[model samples]
Target: MVAPFPASFLLGLPVRGSRGERGRRPARCGPLRPPPGAQGSCSQRCGDQSGPCSCHPTCFGLASCCADIRDFCLEISPYSGSMMGGKDFVVQNLNWPNPTDSVICSFKDSIQTRGHVDASGRVHCVSPLLYESGRIPFTLSMDNGRSFPRSGTWLSVHPSKVSDSEKSQLVNETHWQYYGTPGTQGNLTLTWNTSALPSDAVTIELWGYEETGEASRGPSAAGVKPPTPAGSLEMGERRFQYDSGQQCCYTADGTQLLTADSTGGSTPDRGHDWGSPPYRVPPRVPGLSHWIYDVISFYHCCLWAPECFRYMNRRPSSDCRSYRPPRLASAFGDPHFVTFDGTNFTFNGRGEYVLLDAALTDLRVQVRTQTRTGSEGSQDRGTGLTAVAIQEANSDVVEVRLGEGAGVLQVLLNQEVLSFAEQSWMDLKGMFLSVAAGDRVSVMLTSEAGLEISLQGPFLSVAVLLPEKFLTHTRGLLGTLNNNPADDFTLRSGEVLPPSASSRELFQFGADCKGPPAGGEGGTALGRARWRPAAVFPGAVQNASSLLTYDSKFLAWGWWPWLGSATGSYAAGRATHMWNPGTWYPSFSSRVPCSVTEDPNPEL
Candidate 1:
């Protein structure tokens, strides 16, 4: 790129002082004093028709000499720097009247630091670290603490080492740190597994939406504008953005999940315990959390792990990314179940049911089921699933729901709807989370702690896949993962029921397991073998709304399917629906705008 200044700056031309002082170069433009009091208005001296400014660049704002005086009068070498600032911005012309006099450099108005006037009349100022990357304006102050103007010159600060569309140039090199663009760097240590990395040369494509870009759509040559985001998922104080079509790859932290009282929201819920199932201890591997990929929404990054690290546009094939788990369990059909121990059973009751709950580590799954309805009306043939909520340890509550439209599905991270622009898959959490639109909408967490949930549209039949570690360690309607089929009907009591238990017995067993529990939330009686809800997300309440479909006052509890607004079952399941709390202040009351059920046509 060409420099914005003329070639005379490089040669350090002897600048004029006033109209007649042509060859005279002032050491430094001292304070206005009595002689050269601030002169010249920017309106007349700052435009294209203007000529050289005799005063110093430091005198621009104070004197209002020339608007472009900083850029025009000062010559700074290497004008750009990294956002993690430390480099010096040397402005030529350190010539000061008194050798002991000091010069100060000011940035962004508030950031004023000392500028060392070097031997060559060069003002050496160190830049400060900036949270964002962009053009920063700064100014030079000649007097120690006397007076300095607000605005300064511009310095370009960049976040990434490689410029746009430039090669990373990291060849065959391993054991090195890598960072994506400013907004694209996600939790790489947790989601991406080196074992799943390609053995051959890898082609990585890093793409991210600029935080500054508006989600606007304009017509093309044919005057056709593409579709916008699918929907906006609104929790009490946070929102997640999505697109019209579900494309794949990458992940990003949503806007800070702030509560009403807090200034910045905490993202602690995304932290997971990868070690044990909390039911049965799996032999801990050193680095197991890095499953398939750890990406966010903005960056459509496919860091396909091959040999060399280079940027490319070609997409990775499905055949190359297939994963075969060592052990798996499923729940589908009229919502029949398969335990981690591979036990199969059919529970016809509705309300809410626990698919899996690991208490100690905090990984759990709960599905909301309502009475089955055919095209005619509510059918007497049992119940169907409505919503499935997956709590990744303490992190985001990802609730996959059946949309009002037949083939359409909606995903809510925390309480906000996930708007998938064009990507087919997104890693909502540390897990290699992905969603596929096909015969059914499925959310598959392909990390080492495997899990997959699919919901059939129209009918809303759900199918869930459990990892092997869940064996004998989990509790819920799906039953303990232990291989004993008879124990599948085990209640919180040590009483083991026979396989031929009556319909009434099965219903009670489901109730025992689908617990907000007996003792204060999930703390149940001894030997009560059931799944209970944990207060994973803040703002969980037992108000009638249950936050399912209530778009009203969104108070505490961001978890799905419910919390103890008053208590029904499970720590926070569908104790029913949340009562609208719009009338009351969220912080003071559990009021809601509307039932936050992601379901478009929820009954409640």
Candidate 2:
């Protein structure tokens, strides 16, 4: 304890002193500490220069703590600018605590402004001059006492009156007015006062004002009229006429039905009266029977001798009813003409064959002839003659073979037999042939005993097949009740009867029941009757049950009369709603209603 030591070893340690002497404390080892009067924690003062204390050595030398506070506040305060006369000035620099701190300024008892500082420490502040009152009391604060010179102070400034000229300039610079003039069409001529605007302004814009009142009310505003109901005719002012001269038939309901005339006439005629008897020309052929001749010649030359047949030289008959019309003349002359006697004939002569044209594709052939027995004194009954026509490269030929009592006429196509017949006449339809134009056709005939063959009245004809037409029958029992020819009814493709009227008798059945309600107003009632038992009991049930009652009378008169009524009622009830009315009936409301009602008060 008495040994001496270096001063460095005792620098940080407490030293012992002699009796009646004070002990000396060691010097602090860490960096210099801030003055006792410094505001805020040590870490805060060290990091933030704008804090209450700068914590710098130079600032610490100040004699008064308030001096340092004053200096810090001035350094961070926003720079001020000269104030213009008669205008409010804004001071935006005060830094306040975030979130919870606010800046409150009191210029006078009646002039106090308070606002919060943003996160960025920018103060939302404004100061107005009060020069008329001379010195004005001004006090600024962040919150509570966190402000320099935490007390009210007086600031001196003169407030001058705003001049009339200056006020006019400000009014002109701040506001704009627009003038509108009505123009042609729907356009408006708009002009604005640009004299008050600044010279540097480049563009001016116009805006339209939205209407806040109720919309206009009228029929046009309501909506467009609905479309015409389906299955109903919409003949507006147009007129139609039916030609009686033209062959036409009308249904019991007066709806005209159209048909094609088989005769060579431009006017349409009644289809049923077309093929009546006692005519020179056949119903199937209108003019010359070239098709029939060509068909006969084709068969003759292609099937038998391609060299013997020849075209017939004939003329129209004076009377069609007396003998076969000239139209029935054979393409390969009559058998007697070809055979001379009934045994032999020539072949391959010049102008001897008719040419088959390729333009004929689908063909229909009708032939009428009665078979007869051959020559007498023979035991064999004569079969129909066999005629053949063959086409050859150099010359066409015709071959005739005597039959051995075969009565049936056998038809062959390309060496293949198709059909055989023994009737007086044959009607062949849907015949497809492949003969080319300019192809030679010939004919020859044979029989067991030289039999005689004669052509019947208008016996033969040929024509091309046309496209099939689909005819729809729309006749209904109710159609017979009304037969007014003036009331026109047209059939359009794809039109179908409404379900309500499908089985029910139409109103046209009797005058007692009114026609279908005008303009679809009461049609729904009829549709409802189709399903409602109560509605059916009035008339519909009776109409439907009448047939059953009539039939039941024959079986057992009044034995089960109630059964029919019960069934009718049950059917009506079951059928109600069974069919969808929308699918069966037509709708008139094709357009949506417009919404023009204005709400006086709407939710914000």
Candidate 3:
């Protein structure tokens, strides 16, 4: 009846069967659809009675080419499978070589799966499906109205029947599911079981449904698993701290100059006590050495000491009178009139006086006196008179008067009096005085019984206070001196001299004295126009030379010539002997010139 199956057929070769048994026999492969306009198609034909058709060249033939007619092909309805064919059934398996067809459903990027048929006849043909949402659709194909095997579909598994092995797999993989069954259209929905999944799991998985008849296939057939849901369980948040790099600031030590806040005072008002013994002049006349005269000429003595002619007998010209005075000066005296050999001044008579011309702001005067009991009948007997007065030239009235009485000294500032008890040494600070330019300061004994006042041996000293504003923009002495040292010499506080106090001669010794004796004048005749010879006792060359050399270099470099010594003058000659302080000498020549000797016997 079967026409006697060919021997090849008995040996397991493909053979054509009757049309009625075509459903039971393996279907022959048909020609594959050609690509659009390709002008070609698969060479083999189906249902051919000729020799066995060579459809499968290799073990597994090329995958079926499903042409997507529309961009929305992936959105096909699971129930209708409308994208396939109008009959609700498509050629899922073409000439497939299998005893029973199995559906292989795979998901792309959605919850639904595309139905496929695996020709291998393995029940476990469907691969694992991944879903972002908990709801998943498992699709299958029906065979001519026959229901699929209930044991092999996702719909067949009950929650209570889930095996321990499946439960373990779900827990280890952090996956969960809710079993679902196929509807009238063979479309099933599998919902993720939230109870079985960890709280951080954003997606759920429906691993291939392992029905009773399904074969166990490894992950090689499983599709790519979907990544965890985009925004779920962020692995804790990250935080950081930033720096701006400007946290701290500092400066090197000693770089900052002293400030008023740190010094506790706004002005440089440090005071000093002359406790050291007085320096003595050598027995030989100072400036007599040859080196002294040479250095003096080298520096042009007239430029520093215009009054040098008084002792040198040099020409007195405009050059000598036009010289500028030093910024600071100390008190000096003559040997005969008022002998102040550095320590003290000896006032021998009423005619003797010590005169100083300075733009003084604050003047501090210290004096020592010894009074001898004198005859009551003498002209200066009962009252010992020692006085210090400040006045203008040719003035009848004094601006300030300080005098010694019987047991105290009275200060009369424009007739207003401040008295202090007389002691062996008196320290008087005269502040807020209005001494101005061209003012004359005289220290004298107006009347003397047998009283002797000593202004030498540090017994008499004066400290001149500069204006407070002098250092307004100056950081230190360096700034003030580098600029004009004599910039502002006006007193910060002082009373102006009244016009009535002016006279033709600003200074006079006693009531009867017309003027100072020719050589008895205790001050430089050129007044502020001449520099005050630094009071350097013959033996004080070391200290004086050091100060002079320093001031000279400062002036030469165009800096303000500031000699910090409490008592000294800047001598230009010292600039030459800078390397040797011991050999340096005063600029003045000690030997009296013939011209000076001829004029008068001058006071030393």
Q: How many clashes in candidate 3?
A: 22
Cα-lDDT of candidate 3: 0.22
Clashes of each: 80, 27, 22
> lDDT, candidate 3, residue 524?
27
lDDT of 2 at 443: 25
Question: Distance from true position, residue 3, model 1, in Å?
Answer: 28
Mark the 10 consecutive residues where model 3 has the least summed lDDT: 275-284
**Which candidate, 1 or 2, has the higher lDDT?**
1
Question: How well is each residue in 493-559 modelled by candidate 3, as lDDT tens digits?
Answer: 2222222322211111111112222342213232212222222111111221111111123222211
Candidate 2 has its poorest 10 consecutive residues by lDDT at: 590-599
Residue-level lDDT of model 1, residues 1-604, one tens digit each, is: 0111111111111111111212223354443321133234322132221222223322322232343344334545445554434445566533443334455667766666676654444556666543223346676655553555323344433233212222122322221133443434444321122232223333332212112212212311111111213332111111222111211222265333322223122222111223111101111100111111112211233232332112121222122134545555666666677655566677665555566665544666777665555677756555666677776565556777666657667666655455444233443343434566533444544334555556554545554555555556666666666667767666655666677877656655553322242443234232133224322221122333232332222223433223434353332332222221211112213222222232212232
Model 2 Cα lDDT, one tens digit per residue, 200-219: 34332221111111112211
Error of 3 at 141 (Å): 99
What is the lDDT for 303 in model 2? 31
Candidate that scores best on lDDT? 1
lDDT of each: 0.41, 0.23, 0.22
TM-score to native of every candidate shown: 0.38, 0.16, 0.17
